[model samples]
Target: MSKKFVLIYGDAFVDYIAEDQSNSRFTKFLGGATVNVAAGVARLGAASSFITVTGENETSEFVRNELAEEGVDLSFSQIVPEKEVSGVYVHLLENNERHFERYVDVTPDIQVDFSAIKNEIIHETSVFHFCSGTLFHPIALGTTRKIVENMKKSNVLISFDANIRPLRWSSEESCRETISSFFNMVDILKLTEEELFFLTETTSIEDGIKSMQQYNIEALLITIGAEGTYAVLHGEVVHVPVEKVIPVDTTGAGDAFVAGILSKIYLEGHPSTKEDWIRYIAFSNRLGGICATKPGALSAMPRLKDLQ
Candidate 1:
């Protein structure tokens, strides 16, 4: 069966990339974890859809148009009040690393109504992508739960990224609670080395993976930056080496890695062996490595041709 990749319930951001110390020029790009992953999946020749909220302003219009051009569905995405702007963040680039200073408070103001496409699209998905940051917003949190419940009933494969932004949550304990609660519901999880230690409250990566074994997760992908990626598959762990690259910006590399894994699974089917898992991680690492070479997240994402 042909499968669809759907990214559910996340925010959209208009990122302003600063030119230099002169602060004379800036470029805007479509961003957000879900948006980056959605675009990455589509560029890899998969059927991708983004289920999120946006206002009817020019920035939102740019977002809608760009995703549509990339072949991501916006049918289920809702429009909020015109006065309410979509989230905006300033991307500060220094020494090939990126930092963000957000301007908007992403609260309950732009929560999506999943009911809009629940009956029509939820069951048709093969992979449902989730991010933990959405849980910080009251209404989006509830909406995320509703979507997950439906996905459970439909037996859709759920992939989650903690994507933890500490500033967004009320407290570290609360963040852990919200993220930990969804562990059992997800089929695949992607986490950075720091997030692994933070969420599991374990000092080492091995213990962190062991801590999540009680959950129903089938696979866990841990990205250790320059050290490459590790995947826990069928009780065995496999490490894949990353391609060396001179990075221009490393903003959404992890999100692109998530997209590569999902894209490979959608095309090749779920892996049954450690070797299969290794192959998938290698492809994912390549996509991520390529994304880092470019400046913006969404724009920097690789296409199928680029991967070739």
Candidate 2:
């Protein structure tokens, strides 16, 4: 049997991507990286599942329906009618990293009964994917920690995206401190080269990989944008080059990579060993490269057939 790939996302939304033009068109897709990963996995015809909490409003309902459409297992997601959905403000630039501002007014505390999360998500999860953006919020921070502690017993392969943001954290030092601490707990750490630099204040990719290896992490995926990707596993480094495509918008490229990597691992790696993980990183990088060539993150996500 293949190990299940379970992902957790902070459910919120926005027409985040605006631009510096009068005739700018804003395309609204699922905003959160975790949520985008879920959709990306589903697009590849894999069993991608997500756990999240949303407010009891139209926004929450829309997100639920989107998850359903993607066929992601939503057994762990919550709809707290007391809160409002999270949101983002994206400033789009033609070929630059999209700028962002987030909103979480009425953000409420969330608690998921471990019994329920395990029964529904853990027993079946081969790998657990986590995000850093959601941790910036105090309301959901402790809840995140509890989920991590509760889920450890299952021996699921842990993957954390140190998706760091200076604007969101209390201070640069504080964010880096928390991120470094958390990455130690997870098995595989995925993030862009920029994130690694920000979190560790290190400039070299080799040094960054070495830094993460201290955590006893099995693998590290460093997304290098249009230049492609690099990975280090069990002290051996491998590189996957990207295929250049005229990019419309690189918004979901990284999320697509996460999906592709997890899907390949879940499908090809029944045993889910350290060895299998090394191979998964290579294939995952290819998936990300494929995403960069296309437009929207969800739409840009490649099918399994594309890999062949």
Candidate 3:
């Protein structure tokens, strides 16, 4: 049987989240968009495999341990003694919204090499998921492209999330251009309202979809927070709503959402019809909604037991 795991690639981050606007008191947690998704999928009772590089220091050890405890497979991950994991300081607003204050990285050049991944892993991967977090680094970018091309040849489903971090890119144009270049290659693309506007330079969702129609992407999902998701699947547009929830912290909600969708795809096969797509989107929205009701990113991700 195929491994049926969601293969994820990206950087691992140590998130220092502030308790309040003061930004004085902070708590550390295992983070990064891909980390959250990998853990979240595993929590939902699906197989998840992570591809990342970490250092030999205490912080890196903590990240590795946390991911292993979360049931994520790290057999393919690498350890670089000189690589210091990146850190992001997130500040909480009065409304409990999270804001990325700053980022710290000592060795951004260290990244996973495409040659390190075994052929068997690629053959077994049911879906390959990635984001834009590490694309700014040339080495990482090249590796990502190589891996994506290989996965495509193996007929694996490719999922791309435009998890845009403005601070990581040199400029808005560079970010937009770099991310847009991968549109035609992805099987599924997820973006936020702000990200859609930024990439397409359009004010409305309709126009944004119109602008992206040229890519002929299989599926495009626009997350609209509580309002739910706006999806464009095979030239068809649909609105999927979600249950309302008072958010305590919106951190990791998008990751949870993507996890839900990926886990569902891994457990059940990919959606083949409009109704099928809607069901998957609705399930994902519920996960996102539930995640927003709690604190922290990876900590807030819903588990299969939580749903039961």
| Candidates' RMSD to native | 2.1, 2.9, 0.9
TM-score of each: 0.92, 0.87, 0.98
**What is the per-residue lDDT of model 3 for residues 26-109, given as tens digits with 9 covering 90 to 100?**
999999999999999999989999999999999999999999999999999999898999999999988887888899999988
- lDDT (0-100) at residue 251 of candidate 3? 94
Cα error of candidate 3 at position 139, Å: 0.5
**Which 10-residue window of candidate 3 scores lowest in summed lDDT?**
1-10
On lDDT, the leading prediction is 3
TM-score winner between candidates 1 and 3:
3
Candidate 1 lDDT tens digits, 1-308 = 44555555578777676655343467778878888898888899877878877777677788889889988887777777553434545555456666565556544555787667557576568788889866887778888898888887888888999998886789999999998998888889899999999998999988998887787778888998777997888667778899899877787899889989888877888788788888889989988999988877898889988966
Tens digits of per-residue lDDT, candidate 2, 219-238, equal: 77788987777777666777
lDDT of each: 0.80, 0.69, 0.93
Clash totals in order = 0, 3, 0
